[model samples]
Target: MPNRRGLPQKWCHQELEVNEMAFSHRGNMTECKWKDKRDVYFLTTKHTASWTEVTVKAKGGPTKEIKPDRTLDYNLSKIGVNSNDQCICIILLIEEKPMKWWKKMFFHLMAHAMVNT
Candidate 1:
């Protein structure tokens, strides 16, 4: 599936799954695989207590560590395509401010357009 940014919807789902799994496992072991045609990202549960620690391994050297905060909006925006013609998925964590309403609406429209296209 694809989202508005011409990117795979799977990426958004995978991130969400990782977030949920991290919170649920707490201090247990869990493993997840996220992949597209070009690359695969693996999340291996390391340790969890109040929070979870996961190691992210991609198809390259130097494994990247994923902290709980890494699942935040700052990271999710980096997962999608940049073109208007492509589908993209983005997760935004915004404050409950009123001024953001228009921005939200715009994103909603764009997402719909991308999906329908």
Candidate 2:
């Protein structure tokens, strides 16, 4: 198992095998793997390593997906900020010529202001 520093420990070296679901927790930090994908780790003092089923729109139709509570909460919290970033990127002007750092920063801030308003 990998420790806090992400170094594998000799005492608890696990075999390289794929599991349907895997989970580990150290203090407030938790690492969880739901399916055949890389593990997702997060720090949380309030949430537990619990899984819940949620309905989501898939390519075929609506499907139920089992997701960790913290992952769901994290995604929900970042919806507005993610949308704002997308809007800023879409509206921001692109210059082919080289520009000064201050001009770039000013244009980026202006784009943010426009998106917020």
Model number with the top TM-score: 2
Clash totals in order: 10, 0
TM-scores for all candidates?
0.20, 0.67
In Å, residue 107's CA in model 1 sits off its true spot by 15
Per-model lDDT = 0.43, 0.67
TM-score of 2: 0.67
Give one digit per residue, the lDDT tens place, for model 1 in 6-112: 33345555444333322222235533332222323333355233333556677885564544432433356664544433443442233234657788788767676
Question: Candidate 1 — what's its lDDT?
Answer: 0.43
Error of 2 at 48 (Å): 1.6
RMSD of each: 16.6, 3.9
Clashing pairs in 2: none
